[model samples]
Target: MGAFGRMRNSLSFTPPDLQEARLEPVRRRIVFYIPGYDPEARTRYRLLFVREWTRYTKRFGGGRREISRAELSQDGLVQSWTVSAPEQGDGAETRYDVLLWDDIVARDFARSRFLSVALLIVGTLQTILSGLLFRFYRLSWKYGNVILYPFVMVILLAALSVAIAALVHAHLGDWFGHSLGLPLWVSLPLGVIAGLVWIKAIEAFLNRVFFWQLLNDWVFNWQHGQGRRPDYERRLDAFAEHILSSVAARDEAGHSTDEVMIVGHSSGGLTAAEVAARVLARDTSIGTSGANLSLATLGSGLPLVAMQPAAARLRGEIARLVTDRRIVWCDFHAPQDWMNFPGFNPLHDLKLRLCGQPVANPLVRSARFRDLLCPETYRRVRFRPFRMHFQFLLANERPGAYDFFAMTLGPRRLREQVLAPDAYSEPEPAVPL
Candidate 1:
């Protein structure tokens, strides 16, 4: 049996029809994927994309001929990878060039014991205060849960600290008195050392729950001169310039660069939007002159940053993108993803109050994990909100509508796939009992 037939028989749900759109020769394509505040090596994301793409192609029927090794740019801020694949039918073979724009400033923040602890403490306090002042707790119960997570961690850590201190005092005190003939001073220092050790031991885990990177980036970037990270901003500018140059090069070579897509997940959403805005700022005619420019933001935590009063630059970027009708911005929101402000419109909610009329550039759409995953798998992960936040990148178990791999790797144009009148559907609210 063919791969498509086998995939069809093996799956419980129907996949989105990739053949719906007219098959065209895909000559050139560029996908710039900006990840959230993650310090892990870029190789991990490449592996993830390969795995998900392999699964998607196997299940949905396509062939990937080659995937290139990671090639780092001279500045070390950007990494590029390529994949060559054929369309489903007699369509053209496509080359997908993926660039990962990484600016993980939190890696340094996380390495230092004092810095990590300070940021976490400050981040926790800031989150609580922000929640109360902004009424984030009432805006969404998820924000309430986010606010409570740190306190819960604190309580757990406090209990653990006390227990450790008591254990050290009981056992080490006796050891010091009898064996070493030391005084009570030794016991106090020992207890203090033990507490510090405990905090260090759980630092990485604490980072995951509290999202220190996300919080720190938001707060730090809002500061004057973006916390002295001019390089970070410069890299973003370079990336935008590179994108425009690449598109122009492809066009000048007489190749049909069908689409240039900028995809960002979580905090990266804001970054992606900013990058697109920067491109527009550099070349006002980018969207109209060249290939189709598209932005796909998955589980965007844009509001978290844009809501801050200090985020004037980010707010301006968002405002520009929202007002520009040339760029197709598709914001994918999952109802179960608590990390992001799902179904929240940044321009409207942020109250940018533009002088001119607003254009509906971002067609906010709902990505339902429940429909994408099988019932058993869905139930297993329904309560795990963090995992669900990443479901946007994972391959669907039972496809209903949205397919991340298909949109990025398949033959269909992003506009043909997401710009349908019925494509952007409102998520159904729960029926009250």
Candidate 2:
């Protein structure tokens, strides 16, 4: 059988094997980090994490904690690292693995400009014809603007280019025709050349401002929503298999893991959900394996694709995950981040139905950037949309409930952090012994 066939067969359903849960401080935790559509994430994420974690240590006072060097997997699909912080609550050791898929993103970004613009036009037309554009606006006006920003900019840039070309053509045409006694043909081609030159001139600026990136992002959403991106599904399968292997692998003395957490940021939110669903479907016994499985989606852009009618696969996966009691899911969103959907309920708002009793698997909470950052810092970054969106992953200015480092490296398990009514206040910096 083919690789896809083998994957399908391996995911055949298994019988349920539910068992009692043992919840405690996380000692040996394994984390799978799924990033969004950013092409630079492969190297950028590690550096970003290290920089933010250092900032985190300084702010929260766990200076003694140290992160080990990263080790890449055989297939180069994952970059794994270990973070040991023995001074925290009861001492914790966490292994973090970043699921790599930035290669695909790079390819998308490197495609021909004609193809990119064509895809953008197609995606925009689909959004408009399918009525998703209006629906998106009704759901989140900010998101609606995000969807339209690229198209609008493209149009404005084209208009500006045309205006410049026309002005140049008039001056050149006057010189060539009236003064030099030349034909209109000379000025016409020069006008076209002038327009092309203008577009070429501003290409770097547009890229720096993320114009093409956002266009490609929307195109990805459009293609993936229509089930055209099998590459992403295959990547998710690999991610699921890795998670299952991690769960099944025994330590030196045959000890099971304490917790297995999958963190999905931005568009990766739905990707992480699909991974957990596949794991559960393949082996129902995972729930009884004595390891806590938790899904944490930060600044999740779930609705961007899940709202599409053709995304039945994603919707089904989300449904299965939501009804499952074994895995704990928490979604964090901030009002300041226009890129994410805040206060969204998958079951209620998205209308996903459950087979059995209602399950509130995803405990939705506000990241509350206003509370997480100091007034001065918040004011500086609040207007910056991408900065606010990334705040979910960055270290907090103050000790708040949504500290990424605290939830991942601190002693507390994700479930504990999610269930606690009070904020996760970090301890004072440990004095050197």
Candidate 3:
């Protein structure tokens, strides 16, 4: 009993110096921006930072917890790390630009992964509980035409769903254990039955609040002086409009842009591409004058919409815009990822079916392709095969991906050297993800 208790105590977060355990992978990569280290501006290079740390963890919480601290530091810097782990424990970590772009890339990536899991887990549970309470409701024959009340039920279900999510979230410390949320299949019918008011309430309070706050802050601060394709796309036209409107008053300042990039990941990738296309279509509204643009898409599922001819045509329009804008499109897709299905010729679309019977996931059936795009522009651009969708912004895994992103994705000044001198100067070499 004492031994077990003592083991639990040692797990608290603590700094590197005070650690009783061995120091983390003593090896460190000095991740900073190329021209110089600007913690705020370097969010795009965050991949390089994350690429360096995925394999390591160190004890951090000062008490008796074993939480690992992902650190950030540099020249004349103190021992500081930005822990992007959210209130709900998720695998995603966020990259922030503490001193350079790499930090931003790392922290944001972590955050994204964290949210993805939360969405799946929380969303599933919320859907299930809602399904049980509402879908399986025993409509009493007693209170016919009584006060119509979805509000009370919505709140009750929302509260219960949140409670369940919170409970499951608490147990994340126990990895390698069964997940605390509802098992698969339960979420679909359950979530569908949950109703809009309840779903939105849960989404707003639990996920949206956390996601939007952090992401919005990063966008407003890090996106200035960035170019098309070179920078990560995190905003919608309305977001861009706000920024443009704010800056419209300031001399419409001129800033030299070496490169411009727009990056999208998973669903975000789709949103990013749409935003970039709109911005490109209306560059005058968002430009800081004299800025170039490049387009980089990671884990793209442009093919998902191909199942519907109308949607396929819409994506084709976006594709054409990418090419027409003369912005190079490097579409990355991975086969192993369950996040996106249909792992082949992107042009061909597949309808989601159940046991060979057509079933509909409205969201997918909606904007994913045709739901959010223009058909004319979607047809023109080509999606080259990229197998590793999960590692879209990964810095070191695939040289082609790394090069396309780090070197070619941004404008002249904003870009970094992705490949080693040997790859650029040398002959053909086998590229792997």
lDDT of 2 by residue, 1-433 (tens): 5321121111111223222335566778888999998888778788889999877667657747778888889998899888875664565688899988888888998899878888888889888998888767665667778888998987897788788877667776765454443357887677778987888888899887889888988888889999989898899899999988876775444765788889999888777888889988998887655777888998887888888988888888888877787888888877788898666767655767676655747777778889878888988988788888889889777767677887787767776776563744555433321
What is the lDDT for 24 in model 1?
A: 53
Say what the RMSD of model 2 is.
8.1
Q: Compute each candidate's TM-score over C-alphas.
A: 0.79, 0.89, 0.33
Top model number, lDDT: 2
Model 2, residue 140: distance off in Å is 1.8
> What lDDT score belongs to each candidate, Candidate 1 first?
0.65, 0.78, 0.32
All models, RMSD in angstroms: 9.4, 8.1, 22.4
Model 3: runs farther than 4 Å from truth?
A: 1-235, 242-252, 284-290, 304-323, 341-389, 397-433
With candidate 3 superimposed using the best TM-score fit, by how many Å does residue 419's alpha carbon deviate from the native?
Answer: 13
- Assess candidate 3 and give its lDDT: 0.32
